[model samples]
Target: MTLLAPGSAQVVAGNRRVGMMALRIAGAVVLLVAVAALVGLLWRPFAFWAAFNPTLLGVLRWTLIGLAVGWAFLFMDAWRLGQPLSLQQNQRLAVVGINGVLCLSVAGALIFGAHVVGVQRDFTIAMSSDGAASAAEDGRYNVLLVGGDAGKGRWGLRTDSMTVASIDEETGRTVLISLPRNMTNFPFAEGSVMDKAWPQGYNCGYPDCELNSVNTWVGENRELFKGVEDPGMNATISAVEGITGLKINYWAMVNLEGFKGLVDAVGGVRLNVRQPIPVGLPNEKTFHYIDPGTRTLNGHDTLWFARAREGSDDYSRMARQKCVMNAMLHQVSPKTMLTNFTEIASASSDMVSTNVPSSEFGRFIDLALKARGQKVSTVSLVPPAVDTSDPDIDKIQEMIQKGIDQAEGTAKAAPKKKKPAGQSGMTGGSLGSLSEGYVANQADDLGAAC
Candidate 1:
């Protein structure tokens, strides 16, 4: 009877009303849950609604907790109703042990799931509490991604990798504008504080005026930017705005060392190595090489892969960094995120510092989801396209505008002329041409180019 109907034994033992009530309630709950699961599977909006709604998340967290506690109680009550005292010793022990194990397993899984949800909630709170900046007048969000290196003996933090991710407000289409650290003679936005300081341009009275050096310069001359909270960052923003001809919305700085922790948290990232990359500094007498091939790299090795310059130049490193960024964006699946939720949240909070407020997280998250289905375009202001030693601001601005137009589908890209049969499409070098591995100075389809 117990096997045929969970509460039937109790019914036969004279608890007829209670057994009937339990059976009805359990059947109704099972039916409701199955229907809901079916609906969630058939209706995509149902899942998205929960993801975008904070209140829904809260309700889910509590619901899981309640269900776990209530289900455990039901299992305990079932064990008691089994009347172990009246049964033989061996049968009684088996029934009690089975009920206890089932109770613990179900309750434990639900409780663990609830804990994970709580951790995600805390992460959301930390990310969203701050207010987001208003969109630019052009209706785009121009976010500066700065890769800060704070290695020992380095004077202050140096922003070696800089890129402006300009996102469309409605469609979420994006254009990545990469700037060479060695770019010189770039102008700041007109009439801005930085422009006032270097009215002519960000040109030190010397032959070498590196763009990356601007961070160190601003750090040394903080008094010049008296009211600025982060002089170096502000100065860099000014330069980037001037170079890209895009208004800045917000900035996010990632500590390169802390970046390793994030990769590790997500079980590392995979990449296809085109060549053998050396790690460690030759000057320090430390040499380690990452053999070429497709494989998953741990935190330490991934960091070096993104920042290595031993057998490669800065341009090659920049291209590699973009590849890593792409891999992280596309490869980190939802299941991986859920499984490593706590570790990822902890690592992300520690590694990243951004001016983007918490209020904008949901909106951005939605946008990111939208972007996942679209192609990502890139334009780098590097050699052959523009002289890094003395960049032409007008040409750079034109290139940026053109890339934006191309990405938005408002303007068709110029057709690429066919290369000679015997020659490589990209420029001939160790890393090949900028467009060889989709490492283009400007490309409509980054993936195709690679």
Candidate 2:
């Protein structure tokens, strides 16, 4: 009776008040869990908050432990109330065994739950950002994503890939704005430290002032960004904001080399192989290739698929990187995340350095979930349409605005940029060559492009 209803034995033995109180607690727990589950499904942001909030998780952990201990005590009290000494030897032994089994099973389940919650708490703490949260700019969150080298230096040093995920705050509709690292003669955000240095734009007689060199420039000219902890990242943000005409809400820098570990943690990501993608560096002797097919690729091959520039231009590599991003969004499931969260979190911590505060996790998580079902849009400032050596900032900003408006259904897409003559062949494991501009670069529907 105690095992079945938690306090029915006490009720039967005339400890009615105590029994009622115990039953109420048990009922409250069940009710709370059920209500939480329902609310979580209806409103995902609540679920995110519950899962990511360290203080709440800590409270939940202690609550589970308390429930386990309290329930065990009630079971023991019920066992005592049974007056086993007056019963048959076999009956006494059976009663004692049942109570022991019930206590262990119930307590064990709660303890396990507590452990899972603790693991999640630790993960949030590990990834916690020191950055202050910012309000969405013009009803959207424009996040700068930088892919750089994995080394001992600053996070923004040598940003090989720079993409901005401008997300709608309400719909989670996204427009990926990619900037070529080699872009030159671009302006910095007005009134920014970099802007003060070169009021006209980031143009020097020498080549050290390219888009990717912002980090190095900041390091050399520390006097410009006084009191800033991550001057390079701030300067980089300024550059992106200036180029895209989108105010950056936050920035995250990921080490390109550490991407392999993140991929492996999710078991692997599925991607349709368009062509034979190279798997090793150009100088590698035992060169291998990821055979063509729709396949699930492990960490190493996937990394190379996105990174390889062998027989491919940087533009093609950028297209493939967007494909990798799309694949990860669709393939990595919520169930897979729950099961392998620790490994995934560890890998992410190693690679990604983000200024997204822990408090905003719920909002971002909800948006990501919403985005999974929507068509992602892309706007790569790449060839044919853009001349990276000296990009047209005014035209690029117009392109960006059109992309955002198209994604939100407020405007029609501009006519596709005409490809150059004889640019029909597929290169860089994507749908089109650099001259033609890969479909993934400027697509209304990213899935078809990939």
> Each candidate's root-mean-square deviation in Å?
4.8, 2.8
- Against the hidden reference, what TM-scores do the models get? 0.80, 0.90
Cα deviation at 421, candidate 2, in Å, is: 7.0
lDDT tens readout by residue for model 2, 1-450: 777788778788958998988899989988999999999999877888898898999999999999889889888898889888999999999988998998899989988888888878877877778678999988899999999987886567688999999999998998899999989999999989888888988888447778999999888889877898889999999999888889999988888878999999999988888888888866889679988889899998888899988778989899989999988887788899878887888888788878888889899988888899999999999997999878899999999999999999999877766666777558868888766678999899888888
lDDT of each: 0.74, 0.88
Q: In model 2, which runs have C-alpha deviations exceeding 4 angstroms?
A: 11-21, 76-101, 282-287, 416-424
Q: What value does the lDDT take at residue 50 in candidate 2?
A: 90
Candidate 1 local lDDT, 148-255, one digit each (tens): 885553423577789998888887887888998888888997777789988878877443467888877876678888877777778888989888888888888888
**Per-residue lDDT value at 342 in model 2:** 76
TM-score, structure 1 vs. true: 0.80
Clashes in model 1: which pairs? 127-358, 128-358, 427-433, 434-439, 437-450, 438-449, 438-450
**Candidate number achieving the greatest TM-score relative to the actual structure:** 2
Residue 116, model 2, lDDT: 81
